[model samples]
Every structure is written in structure tokens, then in C-alpha cells.
Target chain A: MAESRGMFFKSAVVASYALMLAPVVMVIIISFFRQEIISFPPEGLTMQWYVNAWERREFARGFVTSLQVAAIATAIGVPLGTAAAYALARAKLPGREAISTLLLGPLAVPGVVAGTALYMFYLRAETWLDQDITATLSGLVAAHVLLTIPWTVRLVTASLQGMDRSAEEAAANLGARPPTVFMRVTLPMLRPGVVAAALFSFIQSFENLELTLLLVGPGRTTLPVAMLSYLEFRMDPTLAAVATVQILLVTAMMLITDRFVRLSRVI
Target chain B: MAALVLPAALLVFTLLVAPMALLARISLNHYSPTELMVEAFTAENYIRAVADPYYQQVLATTLGVAFLCTVLTVLLGFPAAYWLARMESNRKSIATILTLLPLLVGNVVRSAGWMALLGNEGGINAALRALHLTSGPLQLLYTPGAVIVGITAVVLPYMVLTLAAVIESIPRQAEEAAANLGATASTVFRRVVLPLSLPGVAAGSVLVFILCMNAYATPLLLGGPQFKMMAPAVYDQFVRGNNWPFGAALAFILLVATLVLTVIGSMALSRRYRG
Candidate 1:
């Protein structure tokens, strides 16, 4: 009976996974179709959609823009997030709880609200500075960074919270300076967390839409934004093809990252 | 140390808090798209949002969809989470990654996928017809059900991850001990695992609830203009209607609602943890 129960649960898990992968598998299969519309069964399998997707300069531009923005955002976010995490974890700061809550507060606010507020502030800033920041790529990048910073801080803090403080103490006892100890001991220990945070930052920035929608300029649109636009005008296998490539890329990257560092520990 | 704290604090203040403050201020003022700025303060927008039955209906619909989505995510996510937690370590890791796949695609792409799947001649309708599950393609797309399914898929990963973390922390020995003492598997699960995993369940539920409540892209794409959620309502007010104050008021209400839910959720989770 016990063996049967175990087998039952295992099969149930397999079934659940099959359910989860159904849509994604369907998407990939549809992407290979030669048909313009994404019908149930494909008329013929072709690489034409992938070819078309690759040839679409707008998709390429959007991909580049997303990469650049995610990179810049991660660069800005990771350091500040590490600093904030360190301070919160080790320092004797006043209003520590409040500060922590404030840092995490953005997660609570809907992305629409955040986007709206950022849009309003940038519009006001444009007026004050007499510069067109609203339609600038910098504005979109800044918004993504702002929205993503909280996650990095939270992840890094959680990792820091779980680390052994005695290691830092041992480093101090060995006569290492604070910065050296930090660089040598703490940094290596925090490596998994920092990497996870960076990945989170990248994913959040890349996948973001509500925040980016409000901030994206006419010429500078992220892939998600561009996809949304394409979705608005047309619904075809081309978008599916693009989405399939994106899913594959992200899944591969995540699997590769997971090989080196387990995400379960950091998150 | 202070340097780090001060700048980070200032950044949060300037970027997060200041905008809400500015929004509040602007909420008191009147503005139109034709006029760049309006210098007058008025409660008309607030009064309009409050007095208008349409706005009320929108709020109700938004909250209703969010509530339904939260419920569905918790229902689907809890069992998967329990199974993952009870699984072997290797299986757990694979399950964890599989669950997080949806998050990788994000909202817009995920919603777009749903749009394709939920469309009139999409996979879902086609499958239903092929299976003889329906006479013909029912109006599944552009409905609340589609929006709920889309949002649930988007937020499901969050619920699973959060709950799995909490559930995995529970020691297996406790359940095993219960089983060894002649308790049935069902009884052991109900008495030992369920009670112990309550905190995780609570946390996951709260997270899903808050995310679903604040969702915009899923509803906007799947539900279209016909379906209105709070975030989309806020968007329409600011972008289309060009009414900043009303939109700000709407946003403020959303913020307050989110905060209230967070507080309630945390309290409930902590209480469950203690119990």
C-alpha cells in the first residue's frame, strides 16, 4: 500500500509537470509551423517563422535594448543592493526595520502605480530641467533599475542573514582590515546571493512591461513592449516564434546558472 | 555605513515616496491634456471616483478577479508545493526550476501566450472541440475566466516558490514518527503536515493575493478594454482621460488596499507560525 501510494504521488507529479509544460510545448510546436495564424494542428513544419523572427530588425533592436537596459540596471542595482544589505545586516542603524520595510515596499506597490508615479515624476523633471527625459532611453533604464533594486536588496539581505557571523570574526582575528576581510571573506561567502540577485535583476528588468510601458520611448522599446505592440496589431506565429526563442534562452541560462549555484539557497 | 544608508534612503524617498507625494498633491489639483498644468485644487475627482457607479463596478470587478485568482493559485499551488516538499532532494530541485519557468517569461509574454491560447481559434478552443468537450468554441477569450487563468499562471510560480521554501523547512521525522505510531497517512498529513505547513500556506496565499490584486498586464491583454481592473482603470484615467488627480486618487486607494492586505497577510502568517 505504501509503495503504491508513493508511485501514485510520483505519477501525480509527472502529470502536474505535463500540465505545466503543455502550453510551452504547444507554443514551440506552433512556432515551427509555416502557417501565419497559430491554429491547433500545423499544415507543415518550417523554419520560416524563426527566419522571419531573426530578420525582423525591430525584434533585434528590442532584444539589444532589453539587454542593455537589464545590464545597466543590474550594474547599478547590485552594488547598492549589496551595500544596503550589508548595512542592514551588520550595522547599528536607526529605523532599521522601517528602512528595510521601505526598501521592500516597492514590491507591494503595483507596477502600474510605480510606472505611473515614475512617469509623473519624470515628466515633472523634464519640465524642471527643460529636457526631454520622458521619451529618453535613460528614463526607461532608470525606472527598471528602481523597480528591480528592492529584489536584489531583499535577496542579498536574506543570504547575508543566513551566513555565519563567526567567519567574519575569525577574519578580523587574523588581523585582516575590515575592507580586506569584506573583500576576501564576506564577498566570497555572499557570492551565491549576489549572483542570484544579479540574475533576478536581469530577469526582472528584461521581463518588465508595466513599468517599461509607461517609460518606453517611441524608438526605444524593449522586447516585451515591442511584443505587446505586435500583439495589439497582429497575432501570429512570429510572436510565438519570438517567445519560443526567449523561453529557450532563459531556460538554458537558468539551467546553466543552477549548475553552478543553486537558486533555492539564495531566493 | 551612514553614507550607504543615507543615499539608499534618499533614493527610495525621491523615487518611491516623492512621486506618491507629488501624486497626492496633484490629486488635489485639476488638469487636462489640453492644459499642461492646472493650478487649482479640487475634490471633484475624488468625489467623481466615489460617486460614479462605473468606477465602483470597476473596483468590484478588479477585486473580484484578483480574489478568484488568489484562491485558484492557492488551491493549485498548495498541493504541488506539498508534493515538492515531500519529494527527494533531486526531484525537489527539478520541480523548483520547473515552477520558476513561468516567472522567466514574465507578465507580458506570459499574457501574450495566454492571448494566443485563449483566442477564438486558439489551442484551448481547438482542444475542447477536438475532445468533444464542447459543441463549439465557447466564448472563453476576453472573459474574466481567461483573465483569471492568465493571472493565476503568472502568479502561480510565486505561490509555489514561497510555499515550497517554507514547507521544505519542515522536518520529515515528524511525519514519519506520526506514521510509525500507527496513524494513517491521511491522518498524519492532516494532523502533522498540514498544521506545520500553515505558515507557508498563509505566506503563499498572501503573496498571491497581493500580486493578483495589483496585476495589470494580464487583465489588460486577456480581458481587453471590456474588462477593467484597478491598475488598468488607473491607466485609462491618466493616459486616456488625462485626469491625473482622479488617477492619483485611484492609485492611492490601490496602495492603501495593498498595504492593508500585506499587513493582514503578515499577521495571519505570523500567527500561523506561532500556532
Candidate 2:
């Protein structure tokens, strides 16, 4: 009876996983269809959708825009998040809990609220700085960085908390400066967590829609935002094609990260 | 180092906190979108949100959907989490990877996938028709059911991840002891594992509840314009209705409600953990 029950549970789990992953797989299959409108089963399989999706200048522009934004956001967010995590973890600073909560509080705020607030702030900043930064790529990058940094800080802090302090102390005792100790002894240990954090930051920026919607200009739309706008006016196999590409890209990244790093340590 | 922290901290405060504060203030002022001049402070917006039947219905629907989604995720997630925890190492790693795979794809993509699946000519309807389960394409998309399914799918992985962590922390010896005492596996799980894993169950439920409350995209895509939630209601007030004051009020109320529930959830979970 016990063995039978275990088998039942195992099958249930497998079924649930299939259900969860089915949508992405279905999207991928649909993307190969030659049909202009999306339907249950493709009339015929072809690579025309991919060719069309890839050839669209808007898609290319959006992809490049998203890449640039994500890259810049990750560049800023990773170091800042790592520094914040290091300080909160090792510094024993005053009001550390308060500081930590403040840093991570954005997680509690809904994306809509964050977008609205950032929009308001950018408007104010534009007026204050006397510059049209509100509709620029730099503004979008800053907003994405803001959203991405908090998660990085939390993940890195969790990793740092679980790590031993003795190695860093030993390095310090061996006449190494703070930078040297961090570069040689501490960083190597923190590599998995750092990489995981960077990947997360990149993905967060890449997939962000709400904040991007509020901040994106005519030529600065991200893929998700572009998809959303397209869906609003039209429904076609093109969306399926874009979604398939996104799924493949993300799956590839996940596979690489899973092979090289342990997500649990960072998350 | 301090400089870096200071800028991020200031941005968070001004951008996150101040706007909500502005929302609160705007909620108190009687102003229109066309007219910039604010006449006087009033509780009219709050009263409308609280007293009106339409707003109340909207609030009820939002809470109802969020609760249903949270319940569904927990129910579906627990078995998967338990299996992952108890599985062999190779099976465990694969299950872990599979469970986390959904997070790699964004909510928008997942929602779009559901749109294709649940639409009029979608796979499910076609299959149902062929199987004689229904005569016509069921009005599945753009309904509360779709909203629940979409949100539940998005939130389930989080539930599993959280509960798996908590379950894995339970020492295997306790379960072994129960089994050695001639207790059946189900009995052992009921008496030993279930109680120990309640903390995780609570945490996961709380996270799901808060996320569902704040969710915008799933409802926007699946629920359509007719199925109104507080977040989108807030959006409409600001962007469409051009009533920033009322929108601000709604945003504040949503934030407060989510915060309160989260706090209560943590308190209950911590107490359960200690007990």
C-alpha cells in the first residue's frame, strides 16, 4: 500500500510538471506553423514565422533595446547589490535590519505601484535636472536597475550569511588589504552567488513589462512591452514565435546556470 | 560605498515611499483631471471606495480571486514539494530544475501561452469538442477561471520552492523512527512530517496571497476589462479615468491591506514554527 501510494504521488508530480511546462512547449510548436492566425494545431509546419519575426526591424530594435537595458542594469545592479550585501552582512553597522529592509522593501511594492512612482520621480527629475531623461534609455536603465538591485542584495546577503567568516579573517591577518582580501579570498567563495545574482538581475530586467511600459519611448520598447502592444491590436503566430524564442533563450540560460552553479545557495 | 548605498536608498525612498505619500495626500484633495486647482481636503474618495456598492463588489472579487488562487497553488504545490523532498538525489535534482523552470519565463509569456490554449479555437476547446465533452468552444478565456489558472501557475513554483526548503530541513531520522515503530507511511507523514512542514506551508501561502493581491498582468490579460481588480482599478483611475486622487487612494488601500496580511501571515508562521 505504501509503495503504491508513493507511486501515485510520483505520477501526480510528473503530471503537474507536464502541465506547467506544456504551455511553453506548445508555443514552440506553434511558432513553426505557417498559419498567420494561431490555432490549436498547425496546418503545416514551417520556419516562416521565425524568419518573419527575425526579419521585422521592430523586433530586432526591441531585442537590441532590451539587451542594452538589461546589460546596463545588470552592470550597475550587480556591483551595487554585492556591495550592499557585503556591508549588511559583514559590517555590523548601526540599524542594519532597518537598512536591509529599506533596501529590500521594493519586493513588497507591486510592479504597478513601482512603475507609477518611478514615472512620477522621473518627471520630477527631468524638471530638476533640466533634461529630457524621462523618455530616454538611461531612464529605463535606471528604473530596471532599481527593480533588479533589491533581489540581488537579498540573494547575495543570504549567501554571505551562510558562509564562514574565518577565511576572510585569515586573509586579513596575512597582511592583505580589504580590496585584496575581497578580490582573492572572499570573491572566489562568493562567485556562485554573484553569478546567480547577475543572471537574476539580467532576467528581471529582460522580462520587465510594467515599469518598461511606463518608461519606454517610441524606439525604446522591450520585447515584452512590444509583445503586449502587438497583442493589443493583433493576434498572430508572430507572438508565438517571439515567445518561443524567449523561452529557448531563458531555458538555455537556466541550463547553463544550473550546470555551473547551485541556485539554492543564492536564492 | 556609503555613497552607493545612499543613492539607491534615497531613490527607493523618494520613488517608492514618497509617491505613496503623494497618493495619500491626493486622495484627500478634491481635484479633477481637467482642473488643476484643488478646492479642499475631503474624505469623499475614501468614502466612495468604502461605501459604494460597485467598489465593494470589485474589492470582494479581488479578494475572492486572490484567495482561490492561493488555495489552489498550495494544494497543487504540496504534493510536488513533498515528492521532491523525499525523492532520490538524481530525481530530486531534475525535479528541482523542472520546478524552477517556470520562473525563467516571464508572466507575460506564460499569460500569452494561456491565451492561445484557452482561446476559442485553442487546443483545450478543440480536444473537448472532439471528445464530445462540449458542443462549442467554452467561454474559457477572459473569465475569472482563467485568471485563477494563470495566477496559480505563476505562483505555484514559489510555493513548491519554499515548502521544499522547509521540508528538506526536517531530519529524516524522525520519519524513520515513525516508520520503525510500525506506523504506516501515511500515518508517519500525517503524524510527523505534516506538523513539521506547517511553517513552510504557511510561508508559501502568505507569499502567494500577497503576490495575488498585487498581481496585474494575469488579470489584465485573462480577466479582461470587465473583471476588475484593485491594482487595475488603480491604474484606470490614474491613466484612463484621469482621477489621480481616487487612484492614489486605491493604491494606498491596496498596499496597506497587502502589508497587513503579510505581517499577520509571518506572525502566524513564526508562532507555528516555535510551537
Candidate 3:
């Protein structure tokens, strides 16, 4: 009975694993089908949907926008987040715990609330600055930065905690200035953490929707928003095609990064 | 060190803290059709949110669905997490990557996939009819059930990963000792493994619960318009209804609910661990 129960447990896990991955796998398979309707036992195989998805003008624009936003957000977030993490991990300061919590608090806030709050702030700023930022690329980038920074702070802090600090001390003992020690010794040691943080932040920014939903104005929708709008109006294999592309892109990113970094460690 | 931390501190303060404070302030302000928002203080938005049975129903449904999703994800996640935690290192690495694969895709795309599978005349329905299970398509998508399924699928990986991390930290010798004492497999899990893994369950539950509570795309796409959740309701109020004050009020209510539950859950879990 015990052996049979063990077998049952094993099979149950395997089945759950399959169930967990089924939707994405099925979507990819369906994307290759020639059917117009998004039903199973697809009509036949064809690459037309992929071709059609790429041809849509809005999709291309949204893809570009998403890339721009992710790139800018990561670029700005990583350095500042890494520096802050370094201080939090290495510095002995009053209220350190409170400061850390404050920095990571956005992760707990619902994305809708974050977006709404930011939208309200931007509206006030629009009048003060005599320039409308809502629906602008810079506005979107700023929100993405808010979304991505916590991941960087958390991951980089973890990495810094595991790092050896003797090298930095030795460099300092060698009469190197603080800036030089940071630039030459400390920065190199923190490279892996920094890179991992950047990759994670970029992915977070790219996948983000709730925070971006309120802020994305007309003609500036990100890829996910575009997909959302398209799905809202019509359900088609085109969405499946877009999903397939996304799956492939992420797979390639993971495979490439896995060579240099253990993705599991950062998450 | 203070100087090093200042840039990020400033950014988060201006962007995160300031905006949230603005939200709180605006929630009290009066909404005017012509002015958009008039700088008059009042508790009318919060009062309206509390007094309306419609808002209460939506809040209850949102919390109910979130609770159900959290429970379901933890239950489903535990077995998979056990498997991953027990696997050999090389096999574990491959399996872990495969398990996290769904997370890499955006939630919108994932929800779209579910719409295909769970919709009437979709894959599952077609399969059911082929096997003569039902004469006509059963209502699947756009129900609370669909929302639960979608949210569970999205959050399951998070639960599994969190649990697996904790479970992997547990030494195998404890399980072996229980088994060596003639404990049955079930007893070995129940007594030895379960107690040690409570921390994982607690952590995963908290994480999954918050994610479910804050869910946006899953409910919006899967639950449809008839099923109202706080996040979507907030969106409708702010964007579609043009009621900024009420929207801000709803947003705070959602945030407060998430914070209170998380704090209470974590405290309870920590107490359990201590006891």
C-alpha cells in the first residue's frame, strides 16, 4: 500500500506539471495552425498567423515601445538600485530595516493602485511644469523604473550579502581612494549581481501591464497592452502568434543568460 | 553609504511615496464634472464605498476569489514542490527551468491562452463532446470558476518556487529517520516533513494570496464584465467613469486589504513556527 501510494504521489505531480504548462504549450501549437478560429484539433499547420502578426503596424510600434521602455528602465534602475543595495547590506545605519522596507514596499502595492497613484501625481506635475507627461514615453519609462527597482534592490542586496568584502578592504589598505576602490575593485566583484539585476528588471518592466495600463495613452501602448486591446476586440490566432514569439524570445533569453548566471539564484 | 543610497531613495520617494500620498489626498477631495477634481476635502468617497452594497459585493467577491485561488494554488503547488525538492541536482535544475517557463510569458498572453481552452467550443469542450461527455458546450469562460483557474495557473509557480526553496533546505536524514522507525510513507510526510515545511507553506501562501488579491489581467479577461473585482472596479471608476476620488478610495481599500491580510498571515505563521 505504501509503495502504491508513492507511485500515486509521483504520478500526481507529473500530471500537475503537465497541467501547469499546458496552456502555453497548446497556444504555441495552435499558433502554427491554419484555422481562423482558436479551437483545438487545429485545422492544419501553417505559418501564416506568425507572418500576419508581424505585419500589424500597431504590434510593431508597441514592440518598439516596450523595448525602449524596458531598456531605459533597466539602465536607470540597475545602478541606483545596486548602489542602494550595497549601502543597505554594508552600511551600519539607523533605521536600516525601515529604509529597506520602504524601498521594497511598491512590490506589495497592487499594480492598479501604483498606476492610479502615479497617474494622479503626473496630472498635478503636468500643470506645474506646464507640460503633459501622461501618455509620454518618459512617463512610461519612469513608471517602469518604479516597477523594476525593487527587484534590483532585493536581488542585488542578496548577492552583496554573499559577496566577500576582504578584497575591497585590501584595496582600501593599499591607499586607493574610496572612488577608486569602488570603481576598480568593488564594481568588478559586483558585476554578476549587477548584470543579473539588470536582466531581471528588464524582464519585469517588459511584462508589466497593470502599472502601465493607466499611464499608456493613445498611440503609445506597449506590446502587452496591444495584445490586451486586440484580445478585447477580437479573439484570433494572431494573439497565439504573438504569444509564440514572446515564448521564443524569453526562452532564448533564459538559455543565453543561464550560461553566465544561475537564474534561480537571483529569483 | 548615505550618499550612495540617496539617488534611489529620492526616486522612490518622489515616484512611489509622493504618488501614494497624493492618492490618499485625492480620495478625500471632491470630484467635479467640469474641474475634474476640486480641492475640497471630504470623506464622501470612502463613505460611498462603504455604504454601497454594490461596492461591498464586489469587495467580497474579490476577496472570496482571491482566498479561493490562494488555497487552491498552495494545495496544487505542494506536491509539485515536493517533487522538485526531492529530485537530483541535474534533474532538478532542468525541471525548475521548465516549471518557471510560464512565468516568463506575460499574464495577458497566458489569460488569452486560457480563454481559448476554457471557452465554449474551445479545446476542452471539443474534447468533452468527442467523448460524449456533454451534448452541448458547458459554460466555462467568464465565470468565477474561470477566474479562479486563470489566477491559480498564474500564481502556482510562485507558490511552488517559494515552497521548494524552503523544502530543499530541509535535510533528508529526518525523513529517512522517520521511515527507519517503521513509519509509513504517509506518516513520514505528515509528521516529519509537514512540520518542518510549515514555514514554506506559510511563505508561499502569503505570496500567492497577495498576488491573487492584486490580480488584474486574469479577472479582467477571464471573469468578464459581470464579475467585478476591486482592481477592475477601480480601473472602471478612474478611467471609464472619470471618478478619480472614488477610484483612489477603492485603490486604497485594495491596498489596505492586502497589507492587513499579509501582516496577519505572517504573524500567525510565525507564531505557529514558534509554538
Candidate 4:
């Protein structure tokens, strides 16, 4: 009975892992298929689709646009988030719970709901300002910053909670000013947490689709939005190729994240 | 401290809270074709959403699919979490990478894979025909089942990761102590291990439930036109149908439903384990 139970759980784990990975493996394999349509057991193998996917201007533009947007969003979000995390973690601010809750509110919200609500807000804001921000990269960045900040604050705050505060106090005892202690000691200690937060914020911003879809205008689509539109119009190995590149990028990002801070610690 | 927190607070208030508040307010407004939205207050949109049978079905389907996905994820994910939590650090690192890779990939790409694998001329059909299980292709894609499968696959990593984090925090000494006290392995797992892991299960369930409830992309791509869930229906109302009030109502409805159910679920699960 003991052996049987062990076997049962072992097989269950293996099956679950296989199920989790099968789709990704299939997409990669499909990318190599020569056929125009998607089917298992390809008629032949070819690299032509990858070539075609590379040559497509929209995919390239979308890739660059997503990169720019994710970068800008992360840039804007990190400082604000880190500052807020520091305040919440170290300082005894009034209404701390409320502030923390508000900061972390985006994590609870559905991206589609948040995206739609923001689209409406932007529409009204445009009416007041008499300028279009909605479909532009700036609008996309702003929305992404909202999505990314919570991750930074949450991760950084958690790390701060685990950190030893004696180091900061020791620097203070040595006549180091507050700013000097923060810059030299506190910031260095928070490096792993901050880096992990930045990585997560970047990846989340890059993979964002629902929020980007509503705000994205004609000719200014993010990569996921572009891939979605591509799939809507056609079914080909080009998408398979595009997805392969995405998988590769995400893999590299995750690997880098692992090197700096383990995934188990962060997520 | 005030300066540090103010920028983020202002951003959240202006961008996040204000918009959601406005969305709620607008859901009570009147819709107009020529003017987009009229300031006149009315509950007509909410009434329409509640009264319409189609909308009712959509809400039901949305709730049903989310519930199913949450349940399935927890069931499949618990063992995976167990495996990861018990593994040596070296093997645990590798397993964690494999498990989280799906989360790193975009949802559209993963759903697209499902579309290929579950379609009429897809992989399953090819294999079935080869085995002579059936003559023609099965209608697997564009169904509620496909959405469930796709969403489950997408969210499983989340459930597993959440549970693993919690389960790993559980000290092995407790289980060892239970075993040394003459409890059988299964009994220890049942009375001690399972009860202790309830918090993780509760948390993972809530996270997965909320995600599955407000799902947009997987349902759109996999479930297709025939099956309309709340999110896609809200999209249709706002974008295609041009009814901002109705869409706003649906969005709030989804948000409320998700929040209420998640709170209730976590409470219920935690309560169960507390006793």
C-alpha cells in the first residue's frame, strides 16, 4: 500500500508537469513545421516561417514598442514603488494599512476590468485636456506603471520585513546621516529585492495584453496585442515563430531572475 | 515619509480608484447613441444586465467556469506543490523553473497552442483517428471545456507556486514527529499535513478563482463566439455594442462578484481548517 501510494503521487506529479509543459513544447514544434496551416506531425520541416516572422515589419515594430513601453513603465514605477515600500516598511505613517491596501489594490483587480476602467478615465481626461493620450505609448506606459507598482512595493516591503534593521541603526550610531545610511547601507541590502521587483515589473508590463488592447490605437500595438490580431486574421507558422521568440525572451528573463534572486523567494 | 508615499498615493487615487469610481457612477447613467453617455441617472443598465436571460447565462457560465478551474487547479496543483516543497534545493530549483515557465509565456501564445491542439484537425483528433477511436474530428475547441482546460493550464502554475511557498514554510519536523508517534504515513498526511496546508490551499484558491472569474483572453480565444463569458460580454457592450453604461455595469458586476466570492471562499476554507 505504501509503495502504491508513492507511485500514485509520483505519477500524478509527472502527469501534471507534462500537462503544464505540453502546450509550450507543441508551439515550439509547430514553429518548425513547413505547412502553412497548424497541424501535428508536420509534412516537412523548414526555417522559412522564422524567416518570414522576422521579416514582418509589424512584429518587429511591436517588439520594439513593447520593449520601450515595458522599460519606461519599469523606470517610472520602481522609484515610486521603492520609496513607498520604504515609507511603509520603516516609517510609522498614518493610515498605513489603508495606504498599503491602496497600493496593492491592482493585484486583486482583473487586468481587463482595470484596462476598461482606465480607458474610460482616459476618454474623460482627453475631453478635459483636449489632447489624445489614449492610444499613445505614454498612455500605455502610465497604465503599465499602475500594474507594475504593486509588485515592486509588495516584493520590496516583504524583503524589508525580513531584513535586519540593526545595520541601519549601527550606521546611525556612527554619526552617519539618514540619507547617507539609506544610500550606503539600506539600498545595498535591498539590492536583491529591488532587482527581483524590477524584473517582475518589467515582465508583467511586457506580457500585459488586456490593458494594452483597449488603450492601443491603430498602428501602435504592443507585441501581445499584435500577436492577438495576427491570430484573429490568420493561422500560420509565423505566429508560432513569434511565440517562440517570446518564450525565449521570457526564459532568459526568468533565468536572470534566478541568478540574482531565486524564484521561490520572490513569487 | 510623507513625500515618499504621496506620489504613489496620488497616482493610485487619480488613475486606479478614480476610474473605478467613475465606472461605477457611469454604470448608473443612461446610454446614448449620438452622445456616447448622458449624465441622467438610471439603473437601466443594471436592470438590463439582471433581467436579460442571455446576460444571466453569461454570468452563470462565468461563475461556473471560474469555480471549476479553481477546483481543478487546486487538486492538480496540491501534489505538484508537495513535490516541490519536499525536494532538495538543487532539484527544487529545476522543478520550479519548469513549473513557472508557463506563467512567463504570454496567455495569447499559450491559448493559441490550445487552439492548435484542441481544434478539429488538431493533435488530439490526429491521434484519435490513428488509434481508430472515432471517424471524424471532435468539437473540442470553442467549447466551455476548452476554456476550462486552457484556463486551468494558465493558472495551475500560480496555484502551485502559492501552495509551494506556503508548504515549504511548513516544517518537516511536524510530519516527522507525527510519524514517530506511531501514526501511519497516510494518517499523518491526513490529520497533520493536510490540515496544516489549508492556508496555502485557501490562498491559492482565492487567487486562481479571481483570475479565472475575470478571465478575458483565454475565454475569448479558446471558448470563441459560441461561449460568451462576462469579460468578453463586457467588452462587446463597451466596444462593439457602444453601450458604455451597460459595459460599466457589467465590469463592476464582475469586480464585485469576484471580490465577494474570493472573500467568502477564503473565509470558508480557513474556517473549515480552524476547527
Q: Name the better of 1 and 4 by TM-score.
A: 4
For model 1, report DockQ: 0.51
Give lDDT tens digits, candidate 2, residues B117-165.
8888887888898898999789998999999888888888888889889
Please state the i-RMS of candidate 2.
Answer: 2.2
For A99-159, candidate 3 gives per-residue lDDT tens digits of: 7887797787778888899999999999999997988999999999887779889988887
Best by DockQ: 4
Candidate 1 wrongly placed segments (more than 4 Å): A1-20, B32-37, B133-135, B261-275
| iRMSD, per candidate, in listed order | 2.3, 2.2, 1.5, 1.4
Q: lDDT per prediction? A: 0.79, 0.79, 0.85, 0.88
Q: Of models 1 and 4, which has the larger DockQ? A: 4
Once fitted onto the true fold, the runs of candidate 4 whose alpha carbons sit more than 4 angstroms away are none
By TM-score, the candidates rank as: 4, 3, 2, 1
Q: Give stretches of model 2 more than 4 Å off.
A: A1-12, B1-7, B36-40, B265-275
| lDDT (Cα, 0-100) at B119 in candidate 2 | 85
- Give the Å error, residue A183, model 2: 2.1
Per-prediction DockQ, in order? 0.51, 0.52, 0.67, 0.70
The digit string of per-residue lDDT tens for model 4 on B35-124 reads 988997889998899999998999999999999989889888988899998989987888888998988787888887887788887878
Flag regions of model 3 displaced more than 4 Å: B33-35
